[model samples]
Target chain A: MPSFFTGFELAARLNAETRRRVAALARPPRCVALLDAANAGMAAYARRQQAFAGEAGIVLAPEPYPANPEAVMRRLAELAGDEEVDAVVTLYPLPAGVGALEAALALGAGKDVDGLHPENAGALALGAPARPPATAKACRLIAEELAGPLKGKEIVLVGASRIVGRPLASLLLDAEATVTITHAATRDLAAHTREADIVITAAGVPGLIGAGHLRDGATVLDVSINRGPHGLVGDVDVASLEGRSVTVTHVPDGVGPVTTACLLANIAEAAAGRAL
Target chain B: MPSFFTGFELAARLNAETRRRVAALARPPRCVALLDAANAGMAAYARRQQAFAGEAGIVLAPEPYPANPEAVMRRLAELAGDEEVDAVVTLYPLPAGVGALEAALALGAGKDVDGLHPENAGALALGAPARPPATAKACRLIAEELAGPLKGKEIVLVGASRIVGRPLASLLLDAEATVTITHAATRDLAAHTREADIVITAAGVPGLIGAGHLRDGATVLDVSINRGPHGLVGDVDVASLEGRSVTVTHVPDGVGPVTTACLLANIAEAAAGRAL
Candidate 1:
């Protein structure tokens, strides 16, 4: 069988390479704010961000906000306007009144490291020269690390959320990869997944991917984090994937840590202005 | 198996009822612009707009702009700035420079009845109340018309393009339906298709959905139009789908017509400032 973890490992390696490249460029240190909701799984994010801080400077401000996005946006806008902040990073499940996260980011576009702003996301989608979303950039880094080059590779994304699936697919397509995105309503999702040289899943459904659903030796990145008896289970069935040339980010260790690191990098880029 | 199309039709009827209730209030008609790409497809769109004009006093302005959206945006902005023009609708295959259609739409948000603008699209994705993209609205309308009430129906969308698949899924999800969006990279796509109550294909691949891929009574909507030897073909195999529980919008008569009509409606809403 071909290597299943090939893509994941490649992504890791590419992430490292990007860091090395950035280091060579003498980029400045950065910080990120991790917004936590009362319902958000913060413990795991804490551990993950700590590891990320070890790699680069990242601050976790676990301020819980109401689901009202307007309130959140007001807070975020205040944060963006602050002199101490370099860039802003947020976890989903935002409180009410904070719905304009993207618009808020636009207010601090240069200082927005996560690339969640509609402007950045839209720019990324159009393949324009713009700051790539941190998570999406990280996802691309992973793809580049596992695969020798992403050009012409068929990549299948198993979610279409703006933060991950849609932006990531746009990034991959911009990289010249044949990209496809599948969501809850997709018909024959497995068929599309089977054809991918790489698969990225962030659907938040634990064990949604199993051996039966994959092609031989396909790289799977389980971006979903399901907290239950298994602690942190990714979208993929890691146990069943044994001996299948698979390499996974072990939900606790994989994308979570990398995502924070990428956030810091994004902040650094925003502060630098030359990052785009 | 169970009849998916019938269920879809039932849901559509319910939606129609809801729409009827909403329409009972005397409100100004919405305006939607159909941005013509100067391609052959424009003629068909114009004819469809004529019929819509008769029904709701909707004004259809088919403006041909270069596929490049930057130039198109300049034109769109000029038109949108006009008091007579309520909403600016530009057809797809946007001119190269039209980098972010969403951004351009954002320029005319209050008037953007189709809701394809990035902010509007994002708002829809977040499940906030906003105008939806015309294609998505048409898809929802078709699904609702075919299905009685969309709640809890298994809908599979083939293709994950932002214009159609992603936004369509968001609309369907808001209507309390289960939606899955699949694209070229999905694995065992047929298995998913066979299980769906409704299938909407926008992959732009001609005849990608065939008889073998569908359930006995699945309702199919082909959102893709392929200029083939037969003139125009949809993503679904229409010939094979005939007489089954499947009711497809033929490439020429199906979604194409509805989308144009919806665009006009969007324009009217934009002009009246009632779409927000």
Candidate 2:
């Protein structure tokens, strides 16, 4: 049977370290704020950031998101000007008509803890210093945790969303790994997946990746969090990899926990005025 | 024998359209400015822009090259404030102390004809509307001119520079092609290249790609302009693809001319306050 790459365990370790780092900082308090636009789905995500912020000994400042784009931009501008705030993460699924690009740019790059701003994304695209999207960061950490060193490794990443595959490609490329990015238009998903030393899926399609798609013992990180009939599931059909020697993360416990941990670590870094 | 996908052909094709478009616009004359840093290579490049701007009925405003980053930023700010200038194209190889990112950001997205700004780059990354990087835009046009459509095709890009590979990846991805980005650290460049239906090399290493690295009928675009003993050459040894049925562009006439044309086209679009 494939050994589960214990995400919760690793997150716990990182979370404790984050707590220590935040504790050492001289302060009345360091703050990490979350801005949401009344989207219930985003509320769940905000809760996750809140939990991580608590672990890192940072204040979780939640903003009352307005309905209009201009109002939201005003709120973001105010937050950008706030000297007390160290980082700001916007909850997704914003009240429609407001794009992430505008929201991210408005948040200002340095306070953009989630790395949504183009400055950060552009920096990551060129393999420079900036906080990477947490899920993408978690995927890298999971691969390093399992594969040891990624240099020269062949990686097939399904989905090219800026939050995940696109940014992750730059990170992996910078780490000296050869990366192939596939998406809805990919002709033969399995053909590319089978050729990789590692396969990461963020397609948001239930049961998109399985045993046949991966080489024997390849590490897999699933970033798509979809609500399925069986409850919250990932892009991979984790059950289908059964009895193989593959190194994989358990569905719910895998990428999610690590992503939260990475966010907290990013907040800690941004507050310290240096990258961790 | 492979057909040479003519760069001058597409550029002339694009340039005529740009002329007609700019002529159609009612204007006291929109101006396009160039900011140079006194680099010899960039001087050659700036002259090309000057010629293009002159042809388009746009003024080629040249900022006196300065030796310092602060001076460049100051000039860029002045250009940004200019009411007459519709676009700004910074000459390449800016003084050593300045990075392209800061200069680009200072140029401001609306006036950045080269598409170097993070806003434009980020919009491109997400496949949203923004000025596409000119070299990347030319690469796409060349491919589309030959291949017709890119959907479901496998593309191997051999450089990840902001000017080429990175932007090209987003463009191809948005067009529904699978893209694999490789670089100097990529373990087996030929393995990836051999599997691709299209190969675009921007890696500056002269003769980095050869016939053996490509599929028999694959399309190749060499973006690297290396000055060799043979004068100027591209990343690929185009002579090696002699007998194949490949569709390709010539070294000097391949991607360079189209890049210049695309910049003019972008200027027209930005002047019109739209993305073409």
Candidate 3:
């Protein structure tokens, strides 16, 4: 069986650290969250966030998702200027017709805890002031924990979602790793992965990467969280790919926990004001 | 011998079109250029820009590089709020200690014609409201102009500079190309380029890519314009790599002219107020 890399351990350690940082703050960092409706993919995340915020000693204020695009921008713009709100993050769905880009732009770059703000995204690409997406950042942290450094490593990143593959490529490139980014358009995805020292799949399709997708001892980080018959799963078939002499991060406890931890980290940084 | 791709033709066509765009504007789109007195690399660029601005009927205003960090931010902050300014750009040698990022951040997204502003960069990454770095955009334009959609194409990008490789990757990813980004740390760069249908080199090292670097009939765009004994050169040895059946763009006329054109495109959009 493959040696499992668990975000549960990393998240626990980070939470302990977050508690210390929160206590050190002059006042509890005020975090305002826009709770997405249950139909949206963020209900589970919202539940986890509220519980986590309490443990970290930060004030988590929840609000309903705005009705229209105008309301979305208005609410975000309002929170952006409020002195009490040090951080602002919205759930996955910003109403049916709303786009996250517009809503994120309305949120002040300093208060954008989720790092969905374009300013944060630009900072990540520029290798400058960083407010990277939590999930992508967690992938790098996991890779580093397993492998010493990503320098000179050939990494195959499957998926180009702004949340994962895109930002992850920036992070890996910053680490001096040669990165190949493939998506749904890519033909023969395994051809690229077969030549990689590390393979990270965030394609969201369950069992998209099989045991044949990796070579012996390759490190695989799965960022996909899908609802499979056997509870939650990731982009790869972890059960099948487990015994191929590969290292794998499981579905339930893999990237999910670290993503939550990184969100706390961003909130802490935003409260501290990361701008130079 | 490699086939050749020339930007001179594209530059002429774009310039001819720019003349009409400039005539259509209510007033000349006001451009602010912040120049550094020291060894900033933009002295030659500013010279070309002045000539180009006149030809295109755009106003080019020069400003002294601000003194300190605070002054840099303050000046950019002032420009950010000014309704009269359509675009803002800066040269490399930013006084002594001024960081480009702080100045860029101060420029605000709407007026950052060079697309260095964090918001613009983020938008480029998120694949919305695209105001990509001029040179990067030029590469994609050249590629698409030669070959149709980049879908499923294997492209090897030979640099990771903020100006070119980084943003180009985002644009190409949006185009659905399988992109492999290599930087200074990449070992055996030739091996990667060999498998690519398209190769782009912006490494800034003169003669960094040679004849052996590409396959037959591959499309190569050279963005590096180095000042050699013979006036100007590029990252690839055009003289040497020219006969390898590779479509090589000349150094002086390849990516340089297109960059200036793209800058104008951004200014045109900014003048019209691209913000929501």
Candidate 4:
């Protein structure tokens, strides 16, 4: 049977570290969640994030985003200038007219905890000192924790989203891992995955991979969170890999918790950095 | 017989387009080549670039770089403030103390003609509208010119350089190609390259790849400019690929001219953009 890598233990460990760091800080780290509360989904996400922040001794303020692009930019600028705000994260699926890149630029490098700003993104890509996106960082952390050092490891990452796969590619490469970025346009996905020592899936498609798609004893990190009939599901078809020796992380109890913990850790870092 | 893809005709065509665009502008485009003239090799490169800029009816000004990081940043900021300067390109292999990312950040987004700025590099990585690094752009242009559309092709890029290989991976992904980025730490280079539809080599090591390393009929784009006993040489061993059906672009005549032409084109675009 495949050994499932649940994120609960790792999340707890990281949260503990984050809590200790926050306690040492002069003031609680204040993180602004710039999101559209009009969307029930985003509101729920913000509420969930706030719960996590409370546990970490961090203040998570959910600021409603304006629909207008200019107003959105101005709001971000305001947050950036606020000394009390240690970090600002513009939630995805931003109000229709507001652009992701523009919002990141307005949030500025100092407070953009999401690390979506081009400067941070470029720094990550260039192997410079910069905060990487929380989810991408979480993926790396999980992979490294489960497997050994990534140096020279063969990794095939599925899906090339700006938030995840794109940034993860650079991070993995910096770790000296040989990475192949495959997406929807990829012709033979399994051919690449089968040969990879580690397969990371962020395609958001349920039942995307099975035993046949992977080799014996390969480590899989699933980053996709899709709503299934039963509950929240991940990209991989966990049921299909039942009797294999593959090591994998399942959806709900896997990357999700760790991602939240990583975000909190980033907020703590951002707060600690301000004192420097 | 193998088909050799020379950058001459593509460069001439691009140069003609740039010249026409420059002629249509209110005044000749002004480009500043911020380089360390103290380095003889860089000085020769600047001269070559100047000659190309002249053909495109653009003024290429060579600026001597100060060794101090702060002074270098101030110089970049001054150039950014100059209304007369259309584009600014900070040449690589900068003087000892200055950092590449810091210099790129100081160059500012609007005038970064070579597209090394974080904003531009980020935009390119995110598949947003922005200028891409010229060398990466040149490689894509040459590849697309030879291979119809990159929609479903498999490309193996050797070397993970921030300037060329890193940026090229994103561009190739944008074109819908499955890109595998292998670098010095990659254990088995031939294992990846042997099955690739296209092999793009930017690794500076001479004769790093031979006919045995590539698939039959694979297209090779060499971006390295290493000084050989004979003269300039590329990463690919052309003699070893003599009788294959493979398509390739050699070092001196391949990516070099196209990169220069692309830089000139970017300068023209930057100059024209200012009017908007």
Residue A46 shift from truth in candidate 3, angstroms:
2.8
Q: Which parts of model 3 have CA positions greater than 4 angstroms off?
A: A36-44, A61-63, A66-78, A81-84, A274-276, B36-44, B61-85, B239-243, B274-276
Candidate 3, residue B242: the lDDT equals 44
Q: What's model 2's lDDT at A30?
A: 52
- Which of the numbered candidates is closest to the native, going by highest lDDT? 4
Per model, kept true contacts as a fraction are 0.06, 0.59, 0.85, 0.67
Q: Which is the winner by DockQ between candidate 1 and candidate 4?
A: 4
lDDT of 1: 0.63
Candidate 1 per-residue C-alpha lDDT over A1-276 given as tens digits, one digit per residue, 9 for 90 to 100: 323332334335545644554565444444545456454456456555656554543344445553565666666677767766566666664444455555445356566565656545544543445676666777787777666677667677887776777667666755666665677766567776776778899988887888777777577777777876948677887777766765565575666555655665665566556344
Q: C-alpha displacement of A224 in model 3, angstroms?
A: 0.5
Screening candidate 4 with a backbone cut-off below 3 angstroms (N, C-alpha, C), the clashing residue pairs are none
Best by DockQ: 3
**Top model number, TM-score:** 4
Per-candidate TM-score against the hidden true structure: 0.71, 0.89, 0.91, 0.95
- The digit string of per-residue lDDT tens for model 4 on A121-229 reads 8777777787889999999999899888999999999998888998999889888899999999899999999999999999989999888899998999999889889
Error of 3 at B82 (Å): 5.9
lDDT of model number 4: 0.88
User: Which candidate order results from sorting by lDDT in descending order?
Assistant: 4, 3, 2, 1
Comparison by TM-score, 1 against 2, better one: 2
The ten-residue window of minimal lDDT in model 3 chain A covers A36-45
All models: lDDT? 0.63, 0.79, 0.82, 0.88
